[model samples]
Target chain A: MPDEQARRIVLASRPHGEPTAENFRLETVPVPQPGAGQLLLRTRYLSLDPYMRGRMSAAKSYAKPVEVGDVMTGEVVAEVVASDRPDYKAGDLVTAPLGWQTHGLSDGKGLRRVDASSAPITTALGVLGMPGFTAYAGLREIGRPKEGETVVVAAASGPVGSMVGQLARKAGARAVGIAGGPEKCAFVRDELGFDAAVDHRAHDFAEQLGAACPKGIDVYFENVGGAVWQAVLPLLNDFARVPVCGLVSQYNLAGPPEGPDNLPTTMAAVLRKRLTLRGYIIFDFAGLFPDFLRDVTPAVRDGSIKYREDVVDGLENAPEAFMGMLKGRNFGKLLVKVAG
Target chain B: MPDEQARRIVLASRPHGEPTAENFRLETVPVPQPGAGQLLLRTRYLSLDPYMRGRMSAAKSYAKPVEVGDVMTGEVVAEVVASDRPDYKAGDLVTAPLGWQTHGLSDGKGLRRVDASSAPITTALGVLGMPGFTAYAGLREIGRPKEGETVVVAAASGPVGSMVGQLARKAGARAVGIAGGPEKCAFVRDELGFDAAVDHRAHDFAEQLGAACPKGIDVYFENVGGAVWQAVLPLLNDFARVPVCGLVSQYNLAGPPEGPDNLPTTMAAVLRKRLTLRGYIIFDFAGLFPDFLRDVTPAVRDGSIKYREDVVDGLENAPEAFMGMLKGRNFGKLLVKVAG
Candidate 1:
């Protein structure tokens, strides 16, 4: 086998508290060779998300952890360097599970070629990818926002949330976005065309959210669950639907929150309000993906749907970017540029 | 309007803790007149449910409360004395929203003429009426039990819980019943054909529940929702569905439950387990009512669905019957037999 260098980020150590640089390792390894229907690819961009925090900690989730000696798992945009199958050829740009590595060898499985002419190749990692699909299916299937109703989502500047707001607007519902900082909040309202934006870090977040949603929140796209959930619950209309897609706020917690539990109160509200709270993994509803891509792709092309990418240059800085993501430091879709 | 002697039970006062005889007042009044399309029903049976307790109180609910001067709201099986409508005549047995009274007038609007030839008129107040319809729709629509899966229901002695268990069995699932005392637990197992029955009042209730179902709970018909919910949550399997019909345990609470809140833990379970929790009023899904009656009516006539009615022979006995029903004092469906 011919030896070729591939830059990789391996999980060095599992996180004890908030993740640090010591938890990830940068190394140069031999580029893998394609066998059978496999393809040799060079990764252009690696997606960084808050869910990776769970993968880092060895906790049980929908997906398994990135083990100590394995490359950190992620979705990537890659250019085919070589191919052994008739479906693909060298120079074809594709979406693959390349992780945080410069070179990836796929056995011709779970690889889909992306059309860079219609949209940026990087978008296949953001608005046209998993995050985008998450927003599309969650809103259409679970949230089921009707015209003139209000749909509130946290992490508004992130890819999933940005698409959630745009798609909600396309469906004729008023979109209310919530973000951490003033800049992101402004971008959510002015740049993203959200009807209203609330800064969660602000002291009057609950009040602001209430004011922004005059008719009460008919649908709450749950991503950041904690105080955001607490503030949102009271404002939810009767028969409101909560599509709990993510809970990034509590991901880093090693144990249950401090005492004075309000579970009974939450339960009572659920009964009294006749609410529907559903949690789902994306693949559980794979039958809806084709319809989702068909619905969201056109909106992206016409600029009716907008997305932002927070690209951090280099695989070595992934740890810092990930840590920043957890703390709401990264703006829009946090991605690491693994190779040119 | 001709006056005819009739005995009635009125809400004398609202209770602070649990309801008592003093909260209700017995009185003699003139029989209500039957106008056009109306029937005068002699109350043979009046259902005493936990929901009636909510109506007796001044608290907010999906339905309005019974004012201090008004008669309590309830369903009653009656022998018609006179009717202004062409379809009814004297001695024709019917059912309607006939409060705790010896005789009352009902417009033909919501009244369904109970065919004594099909089944006894009293069945309309038990397994063939509101409680029975509730179990059918909730089980069929929300529970949607698959073959061999386990469905758990508490308050197994009551009409609603009893129907839930029987229907679950009919749907080809194992039904696990939970009741307060040993007698009701035995009844659930011996009479209802439950796979196993656990005494919720037992010190080892959780352990007993765990032992009852080897495969774990798939669908939980939520009726009693305080300590029982706490115990059942840990036993819920992945992708389990909970149909929130009623929170009987927390209905009487004047305010939020006392400290040591566990909301975060419950939400965490929802995320990790991918659980779906939905709250619904049976009538809100009134679309299922006709279908409910069509399916369960035959089951009732053929004795496939057996129900025990605890007849409290007088309007004055309603408050006591209602209180006892809440505390699991009634062996079967609690009812008030207002008149001969």
Candidate 2:
């Protein structure tokens, strides 16, 4: 019963625009003892993603909005401290959707025991987890980057985009990455080995993207669908494929921007260029998860694929870190280290 | 030989706006004799398709712009008047890229010998040919209409739209058809088996379209993308697929339309609803031809597919008919009858 204390963050209210710390509250409750076929978890890390902002809004989305006062939904890398489940035992590290909790009890279903012997436990959340799978599935399944083709991904230093750019390059396609600032751009270019990295906040971002992509963008891994889409769309080649995985840019908007609306022009361009814009959730292609892990996990081990993690310590800092993430303050994949 | 005389229509001048008959010239010329391995073709039917207007203008397109003073290009059903090639004999009915001419000589290439037995040979230029292929491939490939889903096609009485509307119905979806006038709308509703047909020219066309489909449209087969698109965009369901095949309504404009530009609004909807908008030329999906023939030709045989032809007699009148067709003056597939 020493594993009875569960420290967790819960949604207090849906934020109208940018999330504030007041929207989330940290509390402690007695963690239930594992019953038959269950495992007791000591949460070590909570994977914070941009997509969490979507769950904090009342807007309809591919995933269900997190209910009020429930633990803020997320995947966690945890150590199994105790177990009534025969499948797992103490000292076994595993990945589970344990939300923002410091300790959790699992039914032993949907838990995958990680082999820390193969790689460090943190890699499970960064390169080998949801973020990595997102990049793999979106790039291969929707992006379908052809050899010698140019693939452009926004938020290049972020986990999904970092992998998307790298994986596209691995497939023999030229990868152009777009990040927020010069430093992140340099990191993506130098660290992740992206072919070109442009800063979206630069004075000549559109021109820089144009100059970098002389052959025109063949695949645009669209994670940010506001000005980035506006910039990337005109530069798209006649047969470009845009895999719409997330619209992180629009996650904070209360409503549509005021406009001399350009919807018709977008439709016109889509018609003329024969562009393919497809929206997808990661699990929509869950049938490919086995293939995703098999292909991406080893690429991480050999350093052929690289990743960066921006760890914001403690559950209380989740809200502020997420808010800063919206403003492009964090570099790389943003994660909250809840407990050890 | 009588085959020595050739009657043809050529582009006289590029139209600054809607093409007038003055932009075309009808003339008689010496028909060169068929050389070795060549056949003299006497055009029986010249297909007056909307795409010809794009060729006449200096506008950039997927295909090369037709040179001014060149013979207007089109698909024609022709009769072999003389042949030196063993594959084709005189008096044989065939489909050829014969331009807008009464006579042509082919070296037995790019010509498909039509049996004139399966369906009317004219159909080779209409429902069973390029326009039909445009509809089938667009609807099946991009539209991906599910059973019980609502599908919409504009210019619904035209060769392409009529086929799209009918095929959507055959796929077990509800088809909503939009046409310019009451007559065309009636034909689309009655003969084409659409669930509802709305007249685009109606004062309350958008309201009518909304009334027709209580559930929002799931797939919009975009052939005419002017005022109709304005109405269609608002009615699109979340995750709707818009296969933009043509912009017939905007073809005549010399420059982009002015005032109340709606591009931003469209992009916002695209992001908000996770909509997909793709443009494609028929040749992009030409690989589907054999399969298209297998599926659609059978529908034609059983009357599950129906087509209407607006046949204009005599090659000299082709220019006038074509001009009328652009104004939605001609109904269904516009064809010029050159010879019996």
Candidate 3:
């Protein structure tokens, strides 16, 4: 009675620099049936993040790269259609790593149940999800900003940066956000309640950043890493802590950046200032997830922690949305509404 | 009467690159008098270290630069010649920041009493002083190498590096030492008891480092930067800790290093490997000095912890000794014997 074909996107080729639509290919395949002890899932929404750019390249990173012709890996909110396992049943919602596909089969491992009545189900892929947890764990572990200290983050309107600013403000620290344009900057300052927002695209971005934080930055939640990092480096105070979560701007780089080499200067500053720079992924702090949900969910429900989503309709638009998101074209948490 | 025309080295000029003899001027001035609450100290041994190179430059660092025509700043093992302070009297030995002068007046501030019978008084300058404390605090607070983990340090035969390796070994970690030549390398491996010693002068230095660190480096006590860092960067394991105490190699660097800019690569690795890099100076952990003395004094007295000194005679030879130390020509702790 229902259509047997299911749609999916696969990695067609690796890009040399910025990724393009051609690097991904859409295909139709038979919707997989649930085997013994497995559950059938129909995708509701697929989340696109900067980390996906790393998976496309054939280079060694924290995680393995997505091979050519394999379905591009991603997190998705899905509805359980049928279940062979006793724990899950029909019409139940869950968040699973089912990737860029309309339907998939899950073995019940790594699937987190989503309670629809608590909040919007889409929030699972944004505010209460990996991005929020990344900000939380990184700040708690590395960037322990004291009250009145300044905390800075780029991509201020994006999920991780938005949460980072909110958390920093909650900790009684001054929060500064850096975004590309006026509208996002306005949202970061007015809507997100960051102490100040700087436009990175401005001619005097570094000077503006300096003006925003007169005390100098104490905690910098580093997501976007190219020019923003260059601006932030000199502004970092002695004993500053940098929780390096992602280098979204650098994910697409093909080779080393243009000179004058900044490594020596960066290392020298790290030494002279007694700064601490630590790299981390959300999974590294998975043990803290229960604590993360305990703290963040109530704030989300009470409207104290706000989140925004730029959701594109249909699975076919995922490639364009992802490419545009890489260029920071999306205003908030970028997601693809794969199905109703 | 003893010579009233006391001699000291003054900063004649700042060096653009490597410091030359012309940059220092030996001057004769009337011996300073100790007023009430002051102690006059006669210079016994003047410590020469790589940090002096930084003081010779106009560039801002952790400590203030020595201004032109001022006595060049250094620590000295001094004998209390005359005392107006109740706590100190004539012939009492003390460690003082009395610069390069033959005689200096102290207001009793920052003068730590040296128990002449406890250990060699010069140990107050090398093994039991700032250099020794640097290795202890850095390794304890930042490095924290676990049992069986590997620790790497450069300037292997120097005070800091030698102590770092021994401390790492004490902590049950494999200690790898990097030095310039065969003699220093031999001293590091055979005498200092580092698990492995790699010659930075070897044609295949990086390969040798890699071979020595079969499990990869877990903790790196960064005393020397530049090529050693380039070698250590890739070999760093996931969650590797880098305690940056000094950058001896780049102390005289005038400009950014030659490109293909290494910043992006370094930052990328930092994120992907989840590395932790922290910089610190000894004073930052001065509170741990008592604990350091408690742990180290016994080891030194028992001959379990050993040290070497490359002592040069005369205050006039300090300039040459200091210059040679910067170029790694000095085999051990570089000091000038100002008087018996």
Candidate 4:
């Protein structure tokens, strides 16, 4: 590796409300050499997820926040450019936590080999990876949607939400997908085969959601909170299970929003209706990853499970793409192409 | 049944905020004769619970609200007077939903024979009845407090909260009881054997509670939801289980409280800390009653579990006692001795 330079984005400062371009600083640096048992990885694709927003803030959360002047943390599909470890060789494709950098050095631990021949390498970052497993584990272990029961999910065109809808359908439950617009709603209904898809942007979004769930919601796979959560709360039936995986809608808010405080009301509903609201990160259910891949991979291969990617062309465009994804502007699984 | 008369209390009007004496009306009426397979019950004791407040209002809830001019609904320990059913005979002490009346004709379907010889018949109205079963099912099933985990319960002197604290101790978990005053707190600590007791009436109640649970709260048996809930919220550990049984504090509130709506903040905490907040009615777990009896009855008999009764002598004084209990004035399980 002859002194190759790597381009990366770092957290410049924490955002007050919505993150702006100034919050991120892009810089070029010489790629560091891999020591003993280390593999130098060249980033091919970086997965942009809702959880990345949480890592940008200095607030207390499930995981440690990325400090100012540190590479913005993310999962990446990368190629091994040089290897000091016997397990990996130059040109081998692997998936690792390579952050926002175009290159990374790994100690051969936590890096998993990916076969490009089996499926597109990008699928490892979306349908066959953390997001996919999150849907599987959260649905099976927490949501536990029964046949004929209604399962509602928001951000329905995103990686996790799309998988959640498809999986709910596979489990014989009625899948109601809530997306931001007509195109995404159509894709969610037509391509993803969700039982119904409602546009959250529509003036009658709550009404449409209510109409979609005729028997009331039994399992609500909560990904995007805020208005979607408010709409879903009243519809939750007795013993309704809510697996809260993310709150992408409120991730950028600096503090609590204006209210006729609904917390007490929510708690009241929880008691009267016997609702179960549980929050979880995917790592808590990491044991289910192998099972997830086994179940989801076959469905994807047979075209029973469909996925779409909204790939931004360059690493420099990640901040805008990420911000756009937060606002429901991205069409599908948001990814950044870090290498040409 | 030769023109036998019965004294009863009926709903005069729905309360707007706090129920006044005008909301209740005492009246006299002829007792109806028992039909085939039915028994005429003479009310001996009536259970006054927080849930009755919900029943007084026309608001939507788990159970239907009591209509105007109807007998105020309640669970009662009654004496079987005239039995047309083979299973029930005259002089049998049984527990049933006889409402707030001196005499009631039951089909003998839902009546359970009370073993007064084993434990006081009034115990059926409390520690061995609905409240006991609620604490059992919620703790064992939802709360699932592991050994050494700290379990916090509000309304510590009430029938439900008392059972919860004792049951948590039985499960090898540290029981932290929160009550209205220093007296109830002392009973919770000394008599109930709770590991720690905090007085909610104290100005530094939250601070005292924080000091009490050094390891943080793992399972919060939520019977009272207000300032106590607000205090407990921040102290809850990662993956904490909240078995929301009642919101006694908010039952009388005519509308949503003033806010900086903490709903979003609470939901964010649920997401970040991976907390499980579940609401439940005891009837939902009625199948566990026998198991509850087998587990708790012996504990009560062996003095491993202790219970206190705040027995109000007359049914006429019930309205005042019920209102007082709502304001945390009841020292123990609030029961009205409706008869001699």
Residue-level lDDT tens digits of model 1 in B1-340: 3656888889999877677788888888877777778777888888777777778778666678999979888888888888887888888887878788788887776677788888767778778888888788777777789998999999887899899999999989999999989999999999878888999989999999999988989999998888898899888888888888887887677666555556666776776677888877777778887787888888877888878778887677677778777788888888776766
For each candidate, C-alpha RMSD in Å?
2.9, 3.9, 1.1, 1.1
Q: State which candidate, 2 or 4, has the greater DockQ.
A: 4
Q: Please, what's the RMSD in Å of model 4?
A: 1.1
Question: Which ten-residue region of model 3 chain B has the weakest summed lDDT?
Answer: B1-10
- True-contact fraction per candidate equals 0.53, 0.44, 0.88, 0.88
**Most lDDT-accurate candidate:** 3
Candidate 2 DockQ category?
A: acceptable
Error of 2 at A269 (Å): 3.9
Docking quality tier of model 1: medium
Q: Give the poorly placed runs of model 4, Cα more than 4 Å off.
A: B1-4
Tens digit of lDDT per residue, candidate 3, span A1-340?
A: 1567899999999999999888999999988877899999999999999999999999998889999999999999999998998999999999999999999999999999999988899989999999989999999999998999999999999999999999999999999999989999999999999999999999999999999999999999999888999999999999999999999999889999788888888999998889999999988999999999999999999999999999999999999999999999999999999998
Candidate 2: list runs displaced more than 4 Å.
A1-42, A67-71, A79-92, A101-110, A258-261, B1-40, B81-90, B140-150, B198-220, B226-242, B249-278, B294-302, B314-327
lDDT per residue (tens digit) for residues A1-340 in model 1: 2666888999999888788888889999888878888889899889997778888878766678888979998889999998998989999998998788889899877887889897888888889988998898888878999999999999999999999999899889999999998999999999999999999999999999999999999899988888999899888888898888888988877776665556656776677678888887677777887897788888888888888999999988888899999999999999988878
- How does residue B282 of candidate 2 score in lDDT? 89
Model 1 reproduces a share of the real contacts of 0.53
lDDT tens digits, residues B1-340, model 3? Answer: 3557799999999998789999999999888877888888999999998888888888777889999999999999999999988899999999999999899999988888898899998899988988999999999999999999999999989999999999899999999999999999999999988899999999999999999999999998998888899899999999999999888888878888778888899999899999999999888999999999999999989988888889999999999988888899998888899999
| Local distance difference test values of all predictions, in order | 0.85, 0.86, 0.93, 0.91
